[model samples]
Target: MQSTLYPKCVLRGLATTTAIAAIAWATPGLAQESEDPPAAGDQVAANPNAIIVTARRRSETLQNTPVAITAIQPAALEAKGTLDIGDLQGTAPNLLITQQPTGSATANISIRGIAFADVEKSFDPAVGIYVDGVYIGTSTGQYLDFFDIESIEVLRGPQGTLFGRNTIAGVISIRRTKPTMEFGAKVETTVGSFGTWGMRGVLNVPIIEGELGVKFFEFHQQTDGYMRDGFTGQRLNSSNSENFGLAVRYNPSATFDATLTLERQDQTSKPYFASAMVPGDAFCGFVPPGACGGNLTDDLYTAYKVAEHSGFYKADGVTLDMEVGLGAVTVNSITSYRDSDESFYADFGTAGLFIAQRPQTYEQFSQELRFAGDLFGGFDYVAGLYYFESDYELDQSTFVFGAPAGGIGVIGHSESYAAFLDFNWEVFQDVRLSGGGRYTKDKKEYEFPLILSDSVKKSWSKFTPKLTIDWRPTPDMMLYGTWSRGYRSGGFSGRAGTPFSAQTPYDPETVDSFELGAKTEWLNGRGTFNVAGFYTDYKNIQQSTVITADNAQGNETIVVNAAGAKIKGVEADMSFEPLDGLNFSAAVGYTDSKFNGFIIGQPITRPDATIFLQQLDYSDVDPIFAPKWTLSLNGSYTIPVGEADVTLSAGYRYLAEYDQQIAPDPALYGALLAQDFSATPFVVPQNDPRVRSDAQNLLDASISAQVPMNDSGAMANFSLFVRNLLDDRGPSFAFAVAAYPNLWHYGVPREPRFWGASAGFEF
Candidate 1:
């Protein structure tokens, strides 16, 4: 018993390094080549300490991963001033994250023309978020700060294999920096125009040698608004956000490691003001109070004010992981727990003449265990068991002529349990066969005693499977194909209408997807490209319907499922360092999504209330919000200046406009684009609304210099960043009301040319 652990620790370290060396010998080309003959001039190998990710759960170079993944390293993100998830848009193609016109704690994320589209409490996101191996369930949970991150991986396509629930579209994986047996700290601060100020810092401290370590990170950002609220006389789009986190790591023995993390984010903001949805022509004339007449336009903007929102998101979790090498097999044990809460108010004008407030909160806990290793016959596999439980509650307080709506509340709860297994076999020197499956049993309970008499509970079970074949014809090229299954659990509607609200439950959405992809690296690793094509068959799709209620008089509406849909798309990404000191990256995506065998004349909610003559025509056309073309381009150049380095980066993004309505009446195609800000009328097709495009290009650039500190391995850096350096307002307002046929703004009025200089030291 005389300290036998010391000898075992030393032996294990030697064994691990030795095994890694042996693997390198067999592959000879894995990750070590960059260590020696680094790539060409002014080019550096990707951070040597970077944790390689396959996205598909395999171990491969980020540049060589077969799937179409865009990884933004922490340093790269910091360089680009991306402090939160919403800023990830310009860096990736076919990806957009925008806060609702009224708040910050919640954001709408779209990828390849697929998105959640609704911010309702029961809504599930099309893009799944995974942080530190834990799947955060909702879109509201996706608005956290980008603190102390190692990398953010955006995998485009249905990731139904390893990541299950809500991954029918794609997966976003965030890996945070882990505690190390060292002491280090970095701090930065920036001040810019428009009363904007920001600061962030990260620190890692070793409490004991090989025994305990702790890492801490925090950030604070505040900015003034660009618009003024007419009613309150306050800045309309002001914001303030604060985030802090602590992580503690304990290494009890040579093979045991455990970590505990506590994190919180406080965000408060007032968002863009909006007006009521208006119709065209004399549509609202049929009603006594016609639409878009007299004070309607002025009163609509005044009446439709979304109250300021305050959000508090706290996450406290612990993970216990142990890795033991048992000759040819390695045993890995991971246990985790997480809890999250989100509360926000959504204001709808028609529901409340003044303002309506809807508050929602979600609580969740999750745990899972995995075992992975290599055995005989070139078989590598990982098997796991998973379970999750969550509770969601919605409280509605409506104000019509300044009063509450009976103080009603709706509550819902969900419980999910699953088991999954994934394995891969090296069928040949150049080929591998992989397969995985997940069986999930989910149960949900909904209770609206204040709105309904009886409670409702529904249970669903699904067996999702994935099959993939990967072939590496050459070490620099990988070709793969995958077929998988996807699912989205059903929930109750909170609307006050009939039939739909009477059912108490809806059907789950399911999809079957097939995909093929290829990744290739050429020009001596200076250039890499990825391409993928996918087709998905969706069933039991959910659509929001407006049903008139018997008791609520045209005000109460219910949401329901309409029919199925089909989606097909092709995506490509390329990164090329054509010459020394310059790097170019581009991403292009195309989506063809539409309804299949859907009937016409289905009644739905229209933005304009008074316009009555229009008929919805569902002919051959693309689905709403599904754009046919999306593209992004970025380039960076690094130049050596004396003893220091200078870097320059620029980026551009574009999206093709698509249709918002599917009216069957041919007359609607000639409807005018009578935005309130415009004096002229422009006619466009029903599906091509001419809204998503400004027909002009956007440009952003930055320049930075690095100055080294003394011999202590620290440094002071200076950087000046500018957005919209050309002073061209990107896209401003883009909608019109039937009552006010001539008022419109193209898009969000972006800030003008603003520049900031920052100086920081890292140790």
Candidate 2:
């Protein structure tokens, strides 16, 4: 069957990529080198394909790393205008990162079909985010701003053995630029649409010449949001943020080194515009008779009568890293401490029918010690011990019609201990076998003073393992197969309405994955292609459900262990530089995910007013955010003009339609059917269009120029960039709430087209 979502142009591009791959595979000798190579005077003669990465806790070239990873460097990030983590959505295969609706710093990141999108501190993120070897335990600050970053690596599959727990989906590793013993400074400013403006500055100072150095950086930005309040005509989603950090590097001797970093971030933003798809009964009374049937406004970016409170977030962190060399072995230690406070208000109904304010404070401390070096003649090993402890307090208050309805106060604590070891052995010529294992123990405690009289505690333990075999037949080609197991820690529900629900704990979810991959380079080092196919057996899935509670005015969200699932996918990435000063890259991902045994209990009421639970089967439902097809095409060309160089770059991405919800509630449909016999037939949740996201085709473009000032290595750079150039106003996130007599649907639209210009001077 032909797909309407895939345009002809995209199909042609895909075909071209396929053809190139075929030719390179079928006839590697026929590949020709670029006639005109880049000039030697070009800034930094770094080879894109040979970029270094630390996917397995060791530095290795990207083409030689036996993992499915994408590394983005400073130059590419600048060309693509990637400012934050959310801007990396389409740059990788089978990866989606979006900021949550109410929380500007919270990121809902999905790798493959696994995702977790809750703001509560009790819930652990499926994807692990690491910065300079320190793990971020909460989602609240995972959407980090990019500045002075050395590289960002997105690893596609499970990284449990190396990264420890809560990495069943994948891992995002961000490495920051280290302090240099040199005197340098850089300053940049930006101006854009919607009253957007920003400035950033970086300074490096040599404290003790080659012994000690320090780097300081600061960034500030503000924007008048595109969304506006429908009633007051005031900006609803404006944002402001400030970030500053300092890093000190001390290398007194070649045998030992230490680096200390202190950082802080402050952010304030109004909530995203939540548009009511179907007005609830309470909201209907406030509107005209006919106006209650559809949305509140025709404009997707407008919210009617939303709360006026803005969200605020503040965070402080400190990290210390020390490394000691011991003959054939090296010892590394990392200690980190972080604290954060956040307050946000959300209006789901958009008409003040239901409003909730959440205030939270969190703090965490972690320590890690690792030893890495050559164990023997042909074997290398890395072992680590990790300990983490965290505590958080949350207060939530709900209001209905400007009157207090219900709320909950929660205190939570979590502790984790882990030990891991990995080794690589070269058993034969150009062939290696690698294996690793991690044993993790997690303990969680929860207290809800308002609902529960006593606190609850639970503990879970698991051991994850990984094995891989790779063979390099040639210097530029690698073939590997891997088997790995990973898990996500389980915990109690923090958003529970009743004491019983709050005390109940859920089991951990696990995934056993098998992958086969090939990394190859052809065209005399001008073209590179990598492909991986993986199948995962997912068990004990932790699924979140919202149900109406008899003791509270609002619904409660609970996590339950569902039966299992199967996920399989293929990912391919290709980069080619067929001509001098021109480059093209393509990334394609295809995933097929389905629940094997998903069963839920649906409460049904009889005519006599008695309620009974009925078993409902939803195994056929597709996983959320698991689009069947995702493709990205990017190209850039540079031309030397006198003493300056100009570069033009463009990118296009396509995402197939995917379901946003697990499945439509059968009880809600049954209730509606009983009210009216002529109601629409019950469509399968997978086929229901109401809960599905539209296929998206996004385009972005940028042009940059760099001019040299003098021989002192001073340069001026300027760029103009546009995101969402076509302005596709599709809903990025949506959900339906059962409101007794009706189902109230709410949606948050994607950002519109935005254009910005930036200029910077560096020495």
Candidate 3:
């Protein structure tokens, strides 16, 4: 374990070296032309054989572009056994997605410490998700299952260069496998311990003289619960899911093509309740052996129970894309409709007393249109217009003492329209200049429906602009600088906790960012490296405030922009093959984020006249959940045995400790920092200081043997695979308790090491 401890940046050199070696071994006898290595002073052209990416709204080779991006093709995903978007986090640098303790339905995506502060209907994710160029409006609908996908592109850093709002961190673009000229199908199934079972299949059917094609895919997964519930005599934290998708592609002619795709997913899981805290150190001496803290259910079980969850999500849309060769001009149009609904029970409790009866729901829709092409020698550009409208409604009904004492609900509609333009000038063959701007007008309206006297609604608007310059002095290197702006619209509040406080509305938040980056390919594309540094100034940061819900008229607390914050960081990514049959990739990111200026005080509007001695706030510190450093390394080797192949993969991930909450109140502050706050008697058990960061190593290996199945070139392969062979427990969470330091409890622990085997045939 003490082998050379190289940071992610240093590891880049190693990966590059390995890649160069691989290229030489791969093309030993290939003919080399005078321009085979690319002239030192010429601009690097894209690989003619590689699939072109439309990340910048144009089809271009990844190597030829100056943007910082990571592309995962379908073949690579299958080889790595990645089943969903979340699984790619470990494989990609500067990207992280972790379960929110709530459920897998909601995932927290972090990029360069920029993320969505809220995960509710009224708020949107900081990273934009696009499928076939259609923007996904809500995070709730972002949990898409993979099936016959062509590729996934992750663009790091702000994407205002081409993508619009909500792309503060970056963008995730999923390209689904389109209808092909020929027919093909693939089916897969796996079974393992804990009664785990999964089955998936895809089929392609060609009809009407190969002019029309249809493809469908279906996937189902189910598993027994890892934890047993004594009271209910049932499984605890069980997981199950069902997903299906169908797409029809029409190629009436070579110049025009249209596709209609529909998808549906159903997921259900049991909730894992939070563990209770133990007494202080003083009682550690007299307390019984089991009562001090080992297992939560050993001593006492609270009557409060968390409700289970079961939900269905459906997404359907039609995309019409037409490309006509009209000299140098290109025109494009896109329109989409998306809708989703989800309802679940949540456990909102303090101490051992559970607050059951909490239910929530949401609905939304959106549309957009754009066009681009080269007009004259002075500039080549794209201009577009967008329109988005969504409606959401949520209800928070709590049952205490077997009665609905606190009931809350809110309905809101948000709409926005914008026009933008981005253009580039070929200042010279080695240098190009680009600039873009957008003007947006947003409006929102909210209604209590059950409480407010006058309809509560408001409208706010803003304008954002961006500029970029790409300078390629050599075919092997590209350098660029950008200045861009990002914005998030205002939103409504949720139910209140206390009675004395009134509902609060938040205003829009905006950020102005400056960045410089470079991409380089050395050793004739055997290895590649990308690095970027950025600084962002944020204003009107939104934060959730817990308030009293005792008023008869109605008590509600909302998410509002309280103050400003700042973030700056450096990120690097590199990959290469050093030895024949050996490939390696690694990514590392360092972020420094914190509040710039802010003040906090007890609200004078509250009816209670109690004077607060002190309050917990992050006015001088960074927001919690922003890890200081993230490093990941993955390597694999393929060995050939006769006519068979065996591949072994090993990887490790290390993360620095950081706070989980934006700011703790008086009661939670001391426990989070592992300090002593005399006035605040309660401490958070899961936020204990001992559990700072998570470091773990994973080993996975697979062996496959291909045997002739028939006279045809087709063959059958049998394989065996194992994951998490060491079965490390990873890290635990810390929580607050009364009169003591934070308590530590592990997360929904991962599955232990499991082994399985499969046999399949391919032609």
Candidate 4:
């Protein structure tokens, strides 16, 4: 059942009241400390809320920026022992990050109930990921591991003006630490549960004092996995990865600077085990009754698979970033190129009745140039141009009952160009008017060599605009309202089951969003509270679903403009330091999303063996992955133990239940009824329980101590941490294969409890 744990009206009221109180209780003389905070690893600033950010392409205080964004510092990330992007799942509001089963390196991210999860390169991700000013074009490599990181920012809502295409939901920007022009070295090693162990090293060298510097870093890790294979009694979800990178910084003069980076990563892992959830299925009939059931068993870490497979991923990339300061104006350029290749096999039936393998290669190149300046004493503006191109080739083969069922090969190419201009004017003494517009053009070409003799091409263009009005009635508080639009490109389905579906093309999707927000610092910057309420009109959603087809392949995945939805949500984040060395923070997100229109294609077979689609209305179906309420609470305390500082931290996160599929296919149900399948007795519900993941509660804790090695600013640190403390083994993803007599259910479970300890040194 769809869960509405928190009422929408109550959440909205709470958000509004919080914002109003923050403005009303503003104190005087508390806003003069607007200087940027010191860099990471430096001394702590007096006011914790004075952190600087570049969310608008210009340097500004977080409290002064009108956008709703969360900036996570390196220290916070380290406290929780964060490894990859997926580890930040519950750190922000209205955010969800899950590693897909296809590959451990692939991430499925959703913000404000907007997301797209697919291995196909033709489908664009709803949320945009940017690393070091370069956009990551594919989900295959989006789950980046953390090494020498500076900051991570999660921006909620549409970032249309600055970030052009595929940003209909929002953007995640990650910045890596740069060379400091001084000699330094650091090393760390970790050992943890599931036979996990890793080591990392970083070195910095100054080629010329204050002129040029270089930094090198490497990381490697391996884990024995948690899930046990029933056939071989060996681990099925093991992983091993290695990453190395180098950065060179050249600052010949104060007016101009440039930094170049090169990186490579290699990884190997066994895909997640697909646990079957039915007893009468063909494959399940061969297994014991204890292994085949209608629901997940207590021993969720065991998979009854008959075969094992391993997958590998390799990636290489390079980036160049340059900035020129001209007194009143600044010019910046960013150029990047990245490529990756991966191959993985998946057993959809866990029992090995149906198996598939996909091998893909992807490459992308992008260049961006932007200029920022003050046109007048009270006017600030930024203009930019962007160009991006990407290409990918995918080969997929399937095996049914240990027999080859042919395969399909797809090649896709995409090119995009955009121009944008954003401006802010100080209309009044304490009020500002800001507006921006971005014009983008995207062209896509796709080819299916095994199915189609000719390639297909499509083009889409959109002009997204933003308008905002902000008032800073008091120096300690700011209130703003904004309206914006976001767009995502469309293309042909690469995993189409039939030739007709392969040749068909889908249209682009868009969203219109309205938001009101407030940012405030109270009690002399000892406390901070921010709140935002938004309503988004999501249109032409690119919904992907699995359906039975009348082709050689019984089932195929298709993408369509399935539905339009109305999504309304409220988000609030607060942090307070009530004591000298203690801090507490909380983030709450409430989303009320409903589909206004839903249309699905139902397969129908004619007497002549021809297959066609009959449009059906499924407007009552719930949206997938749209959790009603998400909450996170965290606390940390620090104590000065002689010359060393000992700190302890803990966090708790809660996620309400959410659906994984739109609705069961009516045609599949009818076919099962005709066959008199006994499973029909359990599948007669309008809202299938098999397609929903229940609510989850997660707990994590860590303790660490830092000691001064000497007066020369060297430090030694040791830490211990645990995640999923309660060992909640809930399914992160679930699905139903409702193809006639092949009816069955399968799901991927979340990782179990993990405990680890680490030690590090820096000099």
Candidate 5:
């Protein structure tokens, strides 16, 4: 497949984006959750038109919940072609999902002013991703399918006391549809741009009516990439994936219920397209001719190469949950286990001149037990004890094509134990106070037989607390304030690249958060408005820096901690139904963050194949992945067309630019760091290294119709969607290579415009 690119503008914008992202990556890894999931069915909201979220471990309307959160349901996901959390990028305020140049599976997600940017097996996630209430342990495969999902909820800020460890940034909670006692089957298919084709199906079985039931879902999809290898006339970034799952539920009585779900996912794809690139009008003295023309960020590669033939990912998991009535209290249990394996290779130079390899395997198990009930004076409480364990192994390697590779192998295990309790009391008819706390103990171990002192061990324990106060002036409005503390456990950067080992583990990062908010409803149930402001005092910030050593082996990397950081932000979302059949929603956010102290790190490479440190000043760097301003707007209209209801929807998003500058000119880099390292640096005349990515805006639209299917209340629906309707493009994440910065500078282009049709039936 060939892509239609707006080269002239893209090249100009690509330069700025690449520089800023590079700086961000080397900074903190804070990931507040992103996006807004759909509301839960018929719960919490008295208005009957509000989104209900479980962000606080209880059902409540989004507008009434004090915490900041966003939600999206399956309907909106299908219409927008959202297959995973990554696809929600831009649509959500202050949310950024940047795919690693290596592969989409290995990526970074930033919410608000926080991010989990570094790509390493041992690095813990600043943001916790939970599926069906089970924590996803690794970054190796978080970009998977969202088959048969009920909703996705993105919670922002420090939810330490409630969500447990490593939720310093926030959490993403995903819920799947539960089994229904009905006999039915349905299937949907779609074909679209880039030779893309897909099918999704669901089957429901009624074993004993309401007493016992089971449901099954499956998906198959394939797509030719948007780019092609000009050398071999083959597709690049192509993918094939399959997913299936089964869920069973048993409800013997009104007060007791149990559910078990088993699922598996597999994916195979060609590595991302990579080819050496140079600015238009720049001389291609050492590169191919066309590489210097077009000023393209994405290279229409002249060659095809992959050390691993085909990239692959595989995973399977099972979850069991039960609830039983114990006198006046309810007891609940959640147990789960998951395993995954992945291997992939890509061209580091985009010209296929260099090759890279990354392979990993991991497994996790978790168990939680909690009790909840209501007591006197409108006092409500929930208490739980939780246990979690995981094991991981990874192999990383990189080298020039047709040459020996330099790399490292890492293996490790982790364990966590925790106990928590939360209580809420209605002090008066219109005032409420809530308090919660959690204590956790964690331990980790990593071994590398190749290194003489190979084994690394670390442990930590902490008590996190939170307090909230709410006042309801009326049944339709609320004002709230909260104070909370969140913690992310420290770990060993004992990887193969550098000599840094277990003896000196980095300190855990912590955040002290303060927030204030207001949620209100007007015009009956047709209008909703919410606003929140937050400030976070972050300490012991984790950071990754390059360490260059020109020897028999290549460059390596190690991570350390910074003094601290301070972040302040505000967000607002509103929805209104002014017209009889029309609805409008809009959201905006602003953030300001500082490192709090001087920051001096090493220079980052353009090729990105290795981490080689070249002393540089980072004292004035902006916050990583935290845009100054974000805006989004969406609206939909529905009208009756004969016997069917037809609807039209449109949405738009914009992100204000933040600093993303680094070394872009090889000559300038040589003048800046090469000489300082006592090594020869490439030099050029009047070199310019300062670069930036401008603000970006995107638009999307969709149309759909639904018709009834007999008296059984079944329905068949069809829809058409066009994403990136304006064909916005250029650069999102751009960079230059260390070995050949000037000749190898390039960027990851945003997806081109895409149009597709979908049809599905439910009975």
Candidate 6:
């Protein structure tokens, strides 16, 4: 079949091109004008027009920034149908942003090879996500709805020196549409499969004509999940979410600008159904929601025994930014605060008797002051100082063996401070050299109420640096090489499999990276091409260790900093206009990542607190979700249909397979079972689907037309779109927790074929 051949062909072709992926996944969603060609929809806008960015914390053209960054304009975002942040997965090379297996309103954002799925109260994600210059404090609510967005920038590789904090791997920066003086409004709605319905609206008002303006946006979407329950006939993994935001912009004078934004999101959803290796119960109302994940019914069946209250997540935030330009120098200030709460209950067995619930709260506040200008006649410089504080709390609860063994609450707080400097020296006209450095210090404290002597405190410090050399051979072409270092803070974790009292803080992580790349333009701005090669020296890799619960059935989470690791990759992007009304774009990324040393752990300890074996050596594991290859191709053609102009676009993306978790082989799992229970000779299922998923292909297409209403410039359009045209459902994430008689494989399922139609008008 074509589906089978597609995977095989793409796997073989990945190496033939010797090309890897881009940083920060950015899906192209906006509608592009026929006159301009676009870049890879998976990579960026793909438009032939030049893009402006602030990847280095300074405004400049993307091609002139000398970084492996992709810019997604509003047009590309619309074209790609990226309504949510996680929907942008595969838009960037080597980027994987998937739903957290636990439940809704969470994300696992990875860049290159660094990633984390630890749900502990203190573990930091290697990839940092930012909205309007404000850092998202935790992974709890990073999956945001995209309503009125201006652009999104994805920076690949380590960006610590300039971006700071958890950006050891990369950064995803989102810029929302600011208020404009001109009045405007747009409303869109969609209906699709599985009882899906969506509505979105935006309004722009000129409160004071040219000096002051306000913009407002809101979005709501819901679906009746793809999976059905075998017992109660209930749905699983369904979602209902709403998001809204308001922004005000003030431009009092020519050189001064200020903006304020407020936003809120509320999401409610059911948990992913668990597939059991050993079926325990298959009846509805057999057990409460606190305990699940034991009974096996069907691959897509979910057992719902209790009242439906699975997941609830809410987030609110506010930001203020001010900028002043004085001749050749500019000063900027950013202040923001965000709060989020996540509460969820998920079934483990098809019978719905064995379930788990988690409640978490997160709050963060930050401030940054920056200055940029030309110095020493030939040097451009940017310097900044930043401060951040946050509080996080989580409770993991479960009903195991007819007992309440959960309700263990963990709370954590942290404060971070940093100072940074960056400079670009144009020493020889065409040859420019840039360097930057950041010094950061972080302090943390944690308290686990259920565990004795659980109050913990620690601190971390690091200095990251970056240097780059760029050669602009022509006005449209540049070649650059960069060497840089990145850092991620370390803190106490409560999710480890070990006893809460035995868990310790993991060490901080760091990475040294080197990149060589070229950016070029041809055919008089009709075509553009860029490629890059990178190597990373990764150290103190933080891995989540799985261990048998001393007195329970499922495995527990432990955070450990394994030895080290290495990653190398290459990527290329091309976009061009071959004919009038026709545009084609392609981008690909290939990565090679592996652990450097061993991960030794204390051997099997029983609920009686007695050791049964010595520490074992575990090493050379693959990076989680670090796919080996990522490829994207897209094309669009325009045609005149009566009095309206019509455009048809199609795109395809392939994501290579990678490990979903640090899972164990069947034999190793048996050994762990022996330590906890007297079960010997236990072997895990070899064909369990929860272990991982193979590489998969995704296809999407859209058709839209713009019909000019009158000479007054009013416009209206309609669109028909299909995402996942082939209906490929490969696991986006998988988890195999040792659940006594069965090693349960539960996860967030891949999206199935979804089609929708929409129409909107702008006035």
Name the candidate that leads on lDDT. Answer: 4
For residues 145-173, could you state the per-residue lDDT of candidate 4 as single tens digits? 88678888889999989988898899999
Quickly count the clashes in candidate 2. Answer: 0
C-alpha lDDT score of every prediction, in listed order: 0.60, 0.78, 0.58, 0.79, 0.69, 0.72
lDDT order, best first, reads 4, 2, 6, 5, 1, 3
For candidate 6, write residues 1-763 as lDDT tens digits.
Answer: 0123223323433332122111001211211111221212322443346667889887776777789987755665576465688767777777788877564567888888789875554778788888888887777777777766787998998898778978978999998777886698877777777888888988989989988998888899998887766556666667899998888998755555678888888898876554534333223234434224443223434434343548888888777777665555566778777777788886664344456788887777777778887788769899998888877777778775456765566777788999999999998988999999999999998777666465778899999999999999877789999999999998866664345533578889899999999998878667878899999999998877665556453456677788888889998888888888888888888999877664454445444645553344445456677889988888889899988889898989898877777764544544664545332322232323345667879999999888888887777877888888988776666676642223345544577788877777777
Q: Which sections of candidate 4 miss by over 4 Å?
A: 1-49, 279-283, 286-291, 297-299, 604-614, 663-687, 738-742
Candidate 5: misplaced stretches above 4 Å? Answer: 1-45, 101-104, 275-287, 291-309, 494-496, 501-504, 550-553, 598-615, 658-694, 732-747
TM-score computed on alpha carbons, candidate 2: 0.90
* Cα TM-score per model: 0.80, 0.90, 0.81, 0.90, 0.86, 0.87
Worst 10 residues of 4 by lDDT: 1-10
- TM-score of model 5 relative to the true fold? 0.86
Model 2, residue 680: displacement in angstroms? 21
Candidate 1 weakest lDDT stretch, 10 residues: 737-746
lDDT of 3 by residue, 1-763 (tens): 1112123213432343344335433443331211122111133344322335667776666665656677765554454444466566555556766544443356566677777634466676778888888777666656566656787888876675467777777888998777664476667776665677777777788875567888887888777755444345465556677777777776644433456667666777655543433443222333224324543222222212335534333334444433322224444545455545555554422222223333444433344445666778757788887766666666656554344655666666777778888877878887888888877777777666556755566777767787888898897788998888887777666453332122456778888888888987776676778888888887887665433223531223456565887888888878787777777777788888877554433221212323222333446544545677777776767888766666666656556665544333334433433432334333223333422334445555555455666675666656566666666443323222221122222233334465656555554
At residue 412, what lDDT does model 4 achieve? 87
| Residue 10 accuracy (lDDT) in model 4 | 33
Q: Model 6: what TM-score?
A: 0.87
lDDT value for model 5: 0.69
lDDT string, candidate 1, 661-681, tens digits:
232222342342123222222
Question: Candidates sorted by TM-score, descending order?
Answer: 4, 2, 6, 5, 3, 1
Candidate 3 steric clashes: 27
lDDT of 5 by residue, 1-763 (tens): 0111123223422443343334333332221121222324443435677777888776667766778787765676676665566667655567766665454365566677777555566787778888878777766566667567888887888888778988888888889878886788777888888888899998999999988999998988888867665546676677888889899998755555678889888888876543435453122344455544443333433334433346888888877777655545666677777777787777653454456677877777777777777777578788998877877777766665457567667788888899999888889887899989999999998876545365788899999999999999987899999999999888877454545443457889899999999988989878988888999998987765433334223444455676688889898888889988798888888888877653434444434445454434343466556788888898889899988889898889887765332233444554544444434432322212222345777888899888898888688889899888887665555544333234344545566788999898888
> Judged by TM-score relative to the true structure, which candidate is superior, 3 or 5?
5
